[model samples]
Target: MLKTGSHIQINDTTLRDGEQAPGVVFTLAEKVAIARELAAAGVDEIEAGTPAMGDEEVEGIAAVVSQNFCTRVTAWCRLSETDVDAALRAGVKHVNISAPMSRLQMRVKLKAEPDEVAARVTRVIGYAREKGLEVALGGEDSSRADLRDIGLIAGAAAKLGVFRFRFADTLGLLDPFSTYEYIKRLRDETDLPIEFHGHNDLGLATANTLAAIRAGASAASVTVLGLGERAGNAPLEEVAVALPRTADARTGVDPTRLMELCDLVAKASRDSIPRAKPIVGADIFTHESGIHVAGLLHDVRTYQGLDPAMLGRRHKVVIGKHSGLAAVRSVCAAVGLDLDNSVAARVLARVKNIAKTTKTLVPDARVRSVARQELEGAETRDMAPARAELRLHP
Candidate 1:
């Protein structure tokens, strides 16, 4: 149902929500470096940080803003004039003013009702506009809120000239189907652009994000490596790579730079990127299974789904317990050892045994050793037969 070639804006929140992950913090230099990388990766916007966190946060956000990258840099703020003042000090031209959308959050966090929340949104947005700041309204805990309340709140913000409305699945609660319906309903309420922000508690953030875009969201809020509070947010790499294929949508993001960008974030955050992570993972394109490798050898399309070349990487073949003769032959050729079928078969058995015993892929050095030993043994046996024939003839 999506319109093909729709342009989706990628608003990266790695500096804001990503740092909210417990025990995670980025130095000012790291923040600037990350911002530069995000810009180079062609993200549309960067949510720098919460300015209201105090002077240090303001300074960090300002440092990133000073870089003057082509990507628009925005600050996340509370629905308060004081936060807006801090954003101004941080020198960002845009701000995302967040307010609780659910009754539970409104009563518990802000001690206010729907009307009161609406009034606060109006006051803060008006103040931000007067200060020459572009504003976006962020609906916190929107997944659990009433659709009517969301419409009312977003309608008020629209009247005040907010550029976008962000529907945040703050608790990561909704599935894709529900996400689609929720976003579709919101899309009908007002003419404002809707951005979808998802959490990964149920491991469905990426899926939910795609659903929201299909339903009507034109912008996606994502963090590098899905780093954020609790389980985390939807990952930037996953969402960017998935958009074109899943929703017939595209972002300005460059797929090739995703790995380098993710690596920089992982190192700065002191977190390790999981080897199996999609798009940016170290092993996503690696193959070892016999059937898969055999198919890949015949025609890469037989077993290939995502082409690694798109991401500036290539398919890697390794020797493992599940590896077959095709894999062994391919790997050996890479290491400058071309083995015939019989020698390859012998090498395969040894590689499997070593992999099973070590509970890991057999290293290339070990494979080469085993292959050379097999080839030498084959030659010795052949020479022995010829020697016996010569002795018998004499």
Candidate 2:
């Protein structure tokens, strides 16, 4: 378990790895605007972009850097002089220099042996330091790499004065239990700051990230909306929100602004946020089930585990097929209709019918129309009598 007051660094890579998502691209203006918002939200760092992409990307990164936001702006780079040169040209002071760590990636991707690759990492990182750039060694595919190789990479990073060592679950293969054990072993091996970068292919990115922090990772790499290659990376919102509750780790990010920030990123990236996405979703806080809505109406804590107020949001009740008399009464009251038991039953039937046919919650206008029609009927004349009977039954 993490001790109290663990300050977890959130290094957002929305502008870098996020753009790698197919058919997603943020204009230079969008990049800077998003960076500004992230800074205002108190994100610790921003992985601006891959400077080596070309002049356009370099300019975008430079624009973000020029803003001089309180957050540290860094560029992502491969282990090569060309990539380092691109970052230098973009005027970024910090760079995450990544090299493949797994045996398959070594032979297939880099075509080099473990010792040779380690030597190359040393040489490249050394050269980067010479250029006065702050460096973080990205151990790509660390989840699949041998524990000994991970230790070797950490050892190299420590010896070269790398500020951080990132363990990349590039394939998103590990679960929370495995992730905890992995990071715990690495923590025992080195005193250097360990950062966990996770992908969400298995829908475990946020879970695995939390486990890593609990096991002693100092920072987490995340992307807004979990935007990245394949299923994307760990979402910034989920990780930031979960940190405080799960690991006793604190992030500087303002939870209230997470929805707004994610909206901007979704628009810029053309990736719509899921309606049930954690924290920033449109309907995650909306309750339609009768049991849940009734419980919430009684006491919010009875049904809500994570307080929506933390994100400047509140639980919402929608009248649907599953809604009960409590929900119907609540909606009627909101629309200024005094609903007796009989009227409530009539309105609930309509609500259920509408939801059943349309497969959606009854619209407010429709509910009001139904209520007015029901109230004008002869059955409503007995509403007062019905309530007396209802009270007696209670």
Candidate 3:
């Protein structure tokens, strides 16, 4: 667990590298809104965009940087000096200088040797620094690169007064254990600040990112709703909310703004947030089991992990197949229906029958209405006219 005392800096890449995801393109207005949301939410850095993509991208990056949202805006770039120049021209005070790290990528793709690439990395950092921009050196496919060579590239950049060494899981090849070991070794051997970037090819990016943080990574590259190329990167909201509760780490993020970012990003990308996604998803804190609802009614911590209030969410006790008497009673109480034992059992059995008959989760309204009918029947049969006490079962 992190000490919960250190300042956890979140670096949101939603506008820049996140757009690299297939079929994603953010308009200038969307980019501006995202940047504003990121800033308002207290993200430490925003990878605004790649100005080198030309006029539109440059204008977008400039618009974000000029917002004065109290966040550092960075632009991504290739190893070319002109890319750095473009970022500078776009008013980005921070630049991520990327280089292919794997032998396959460096030679086969870039057709450049390590010596040549290392020299280029150092040159870009130097030029970016001279241009009054902080330089973050990115290791594209760094996980697949030979460790010794990566160390050399990272070390060379560090010697040049670069800001940080960005180690990437370009292919999502790393699991948590491997990520821990690799990140630990890198941290142990280098004084450069390390930032970990993970992709979700194996559905392990968030897990690996957590491992990397535990192994001394100072920063991470994340996107809203895990948006990125291929399988996607770690979801920024998950990392933001999960870290504080489980690892006892502290991120300077506004918990309330977390879901809003998800919504904003989803709208901008023309995508929808998955209902079952953790932290920012619609159903993460929604409860349906009768037993689960009873527990929540007693104390929200019964089945909940992180507090829903942290994310500007309310506790939702949903009535479904698994619910029992107490769950029904709780919902009834909320709706001003208190049920007795007999009423509770009847309601519970009816809910179960409804669930079985439909083979689907029963919605809260139908369960409550059925319970109300039973309560009305019980009143008509009795002379005392006592209040209905409901106990819903799971």
**Which model scores highest in TM-score?**
1
Model 1: per-residue lDDT, tens digit, 184-297?
988777789999999999999999999999998999999999999899999999999999999989999999999999999999989899999999888999998999999999
Q: Top model by lDDT, which number? A: 1
Instruction: State which candidate, 2 or 3, has the greater TM-score.
Output: 2
lDDT per model vs. reference: 0.92, 0.89, 0.85
Candidate 2 stretches greater than 4 Å from native: 17-19, 379-394
For candidate 3, lDDT tens digit of each residue in 219-316? Answer: 87888888888899988888887766545577788989888887888887778888898887788888887677777778888888778887778878
What clash pairs does model 1 have? none
True-structure RMSD for candidate 1: 2.7
lDDT of 2 by residue, 1-394 (tens): 4669878999999888433588888899999999999998889999999998999999999999999888999999998989999999999999999999898898898898778788889999999999999999999999999878877766887799999999999999999999999999987777788899999899999999999999999899999888888988999999999999888789999999998999999888777988998889989899989899889989998888989998999888888899998888888788688998878898889879989999978876788789888988845675656344344553
How does model 3 score by TM-score? 0.92
| RMSD in Å for all candidates | 2.7, 5.5, 6.4
By TM-score, highest first, what's the ranking?
1, 2, 3
Clashes of each: 0, 0, 20
* TM-score for each candidate, following the candidate numbering: 0.96, 0.94, 0.92
